[model samples]
Target: MRHIDCQKRISLLVDGSLDGPAVREALDHLTECPDCARAYEKMVSLNNALTNVKPSLADSSLASKVKVRISGESNSAGYAWNFSLLKQVPIWALIAILAVGVGDMAGKTLTETLNMHDTSHNLENLIQDNGESLTDVLIDFGQSENGR
Candidate 1:
């Protein structure tokens, strides 16, 4: 078998889980390849060390502190909305409303301005078509008032 295949089965070999042709092939590869032999030795040392290690106990007060933090009882301030003040308001909604208001005002002003311009232009055209100046029209109106 290839060195890679033997290396993959090294863990199973240490655990006594490999059997039959696989075990024989892995053993043969380990004997022929110096690298595979070294890897197998390291795996054996690691397994032995892990098996000899004893489990450790945590601090007695660690569990109580974690429980208090999770329940929010560690602080006396009483959970006063932990988020930002600006987050309470819908800022985009207000901005959209203001934009619509400004647009409406602009539209109204534009319409009024265009109407005034058109009125003045029509007045000027009327004066020109009648071949009369401002002074002549005023004098005619005054004469008609006096005759009345």
Candidate 2:
């Protein structure tokens, strides 16, 4: 087999997972190819070292410490969601929007009132210029409608 193929099979050979023919081919390749031999040696050393390593026990307070940190993080995330993009908006901009809305409503009301006042003032001027009382104008309007 080629060096690349041998390199790929090195882990399986080190773990004793390869079959008889595969094992012989890998070993023969290892003896002949220096690069493959070095790779095989590294894999064997790593496997042995990992197998001899003892798993360390966790501290008794580790679980409680992790739980506390998770709870604190969740609470902070909740707070962040609560204080959203709307909260980041400037107070002056909100006040300006409110002021503009109120001003628009006030201006509309004033314009309507002024229009009503102007209509009444024009009616009064018409009556004074023609020297006609309110009743006289109404009677003339009635007669004109009847004729029509």
Candidate 3:
């Protein structure tokens, strides 16, 4: 086996997972190659160090405390206002209705204040004039308006 392949198998050998003819080949390579032998030694040392470590939890009742806190928050009645009736109504429909009502009232007020008839014709003219250059529109508007 190549020195590189033997180096990789060292970890499997350290973990006792390497088997059959592959183990013999890796061991033979490790004996002849100083670098592969050093790699094998390091792998063995690392495996032994990791195996000797024991982990411990800081709080034994942490899981139960977290569950109790979550349940208490869900059941708590701290809210002063209830929006159940508001939730039952469609909020978007309400907003659209109010917007239409306000727009109609403002349009009527503007038309009355302007003392103008044929609002649709005026709206069409404005739309058509928007397609022209600003200077041309201003010149036409100036010529058509009565002296003020």
Candidate 4:
């Protein structure tokens, strides 16, 4: 099976939703493939984490008090209708971002123009394709001297 489909099966197995045959097959694959085994282990850990999680009581009262306080403190600032300070923000930020972008582009262009050259690091590939020895290539390079 494709790795993606197998991963889906792994999730189902962890959720205890896989059929008998599918569970068996998933387990079998897990046993043979280390990647699948690691994935299954992760699923088990995730399942344990989810099942053991409980809603906290500590924040219940805090949330209610916070909402009341926030409501008292709130104004048009929290709504889309208030655009006093936010209106200039987009224009200023856009201009600043564009300036920085232009500077970066100019620097990169200058550097590229200064270092305009192509270099080939294909010694291994050349040797493999031509079935030539490295020592022979080096000797030829040394003798030729002109980099032919």
Best-fitting candidate, measured by lDDT? Answer: 2
Error of 2 at 143 (Å): 99
Q: What lDDT tens digits, residue by residue, belong to model 4 across residues 1-148?
A: 8998998899988888999998999999999989988998998998899889977777588889998888866854466446655675788797998898788667477666555544333544444436568788777768878766
RMSD of 4: 30.9
Shift of residue 92 alpha carbon in model 1, Å: 56
Query: What is candidate 2's TM-score against the reference?
Result: 0.37
Q: Decide which is better by TM-score, 2 or 4.
A: 4
Tens digits of per-residue lDDT for model 2, 1-148: 6657778899888888999999998888888888888898888888889999978756768888899999999999998888886798999999999998788668467666556656788886755547778799889878988999
Instruction: For candidate 1, report its TM-score.
Output: 0.36
Give the lowest summed-lDDT range of ten residues in model 1: 74-83
For 48-146, candidate 3 gives per-residue lDDT tens digits of: 898899686788698889999988776663331245555677989899999987886784776674555587677776747567887887787787785
Candidate 3 TM-score versus the reference? 0.39
Which stretches of model 3 miss by more than 4 angstroms? 65-148
- Tens digits of per-residue lDDT, candidate 1, 1-148, equal 5657768898789899998888897888788888988999999999999999968656768788788886776353344444444467698987998898788668477666556657778886755546678799888878988999
Q: What is the C-alpha RMSD of each candidate to the true structure, in Å?
A: 22.2, 18.0, 19.3, 30.9
**Structural similarity to truth (TM-score) of each candidate:** 0.36, 0.37, 0.39, 0.38
Candidate 3 residue-pair clash tally:
0
User: Taking the candidates one at a time, how many backbone clashes does each contain?
Assistant: 0, 0, 0, 0
Which runs of model 1 end up more than 4 angstroms from their true locations? 56-148
